[model samples]
Target: MSSTKKVKDSHTIMTQLIMPNDTNHLGNLMGGVMMRWMDIVCALSAMRHCNTPVVTAAVDHISFQQPIDLGSMITLEGFVTRTFRTSLEVFVEVYSEDLKGTKTKCNDAFFTFVSLDEDTKRPSKAPGIIPESKREKELFEGALRRRDLRLIMAGRMDPKSADHLKKIFS
Candidate 1:
């Protein structure tokens, strides 16, 4: 397989208020809610890259390095890591900023998304390539590593599942 290098564009979304609804009684943002936001932002980035609707196929990794407090501003930044015929892999980084203007990276994750045709609900091919840069190359390499690990895990589960998983993971 010829590796198709994709140039990733950084996209960011700013959200505020970890919120009582988005948090526990202790007022820390719930991991699930944060993850959902990350998915949305990453999907947006993929759509921008592919110029088509995208759906989350899998979340490869998520790590919470710090806690986000209620009412703090949360910034989610996403970038394309790589692309296949019909799928794009994205990496997202979440940061928390306090009233005092301190910003810290609270979480990071890698997610795979597939572009879909609205009517057919089938995978759609993405653009050939974007503008290549050093950052894009680095992110693509990192995402490729994660993709390899996911393939290994899928292969271990079952042969049939691995075949289906390969289509999505690619």
Candidate 2:
């Protein structure tokens, strides 16, 4: 695998219309429905980045900032922020657009995925992210801390061993 891949190399965008079936009785898009889309887009981005079968390891953070009503167009965008030994982090953002082209950010999330070897069903290395924009660079730097926090919360890493997160509190 190459040492690094540009952010655009694995970026993914999906658009869908919020229909009756995707909304609740209140006529707003359901949280689960939005999450499902987020996971799908994030997984696609991860697969694009790794060029292998990837599975969702964890959804680090997902925030529904605003409610999207039925009849709105929903856009989900995802890009690789950083990569670890066998896993990579993708930052996903969801926006809702009205008929007039007015856009509102509805959700934001970070997802982690691990690449798998098709023959062995084992974890495979992921390519590193080479940030192209300032925003991508910032996200790339923060991804390490986010990964440490996720590992600590999942009991896969010790709090004391999390250098990036430790600095946050200190």
Candidate 3:
């Protein structure tokens, strides 16, 4: 738990073909299905970062930018942006590629996961995360504010008590 890992070390990528079963009546990929995929990839990234079992604590932000049609290839990529004492934040992006290789960003989201003790099944310390790239660093910096916001929304923290978010409101 004393070791720190780079964001790239926990990067995860998954691809799935949107089939009839994965679509809604309009032939667009169902929102639930997209969320499922995001959860899977994000969990994988979180587990990789912690090197231990983890559980999804929350889905912080999700934006459906565009509709992905059936028959398209969907790619989901995720990485650990930052780590808390016992939790980690993962950022995931989903893209859709058409038959002709036309790609469009479909969704982006942030997920939080809490590392668990293998025997006790209780919250455990997670390894630190080091963001190397500019984008990774940006996300790493923003994660705390996002976490603060999530806590406020969940009633787990007071708005005025948020470290990063209070600056904006103040």
Winning candidate number (lDDT): 3
Q: Candidate 1's residue-wise lDDT over 1-170, tens digit each?
A: 22333454436464666778999777899989998899889988887777778899888768788878888888888878778678778888888999998999898888889888867878988655553777766676565456666766656344444453456558
Superposed Cα deviation of residue 103, candidate 2 (Å) = 0.3
What is the lDDT, from 0 to 100, of the residue 20 in candidate 3? Answer: 98
What's the C-alpha lDDT at position 97 in model 3?
99
lDDT of 2 by residue, 1-170 (tens): 53678889888999999999999889999999999999999999998888889998998767678989999999999999999999999999988999999999887999999989878879988877789799998998998899999999899999889999888888
Worst 10 residues of 3 by lDDT: 161-170
lDDT of 1: 0.75
Who is ahead in lDDT, 1 or 2? 2
| Candidate 1 global Cα RMSD | 5.5
lDDT of 3 by residue, 118-151 (tens): 8999999999888998999999999989999998
Instruction: Report the poorest 10 consecutive residues by lDDT, candidate 1.
Output: 1-10
After superposition, the stretches of candidate 3 with alpha carbons farther than 4 Å from their true spots are none
Clashing pairs in 2: none
Clash pairs detected, candidate 1: none
Winner on TM-score between 1 and 3 is 3
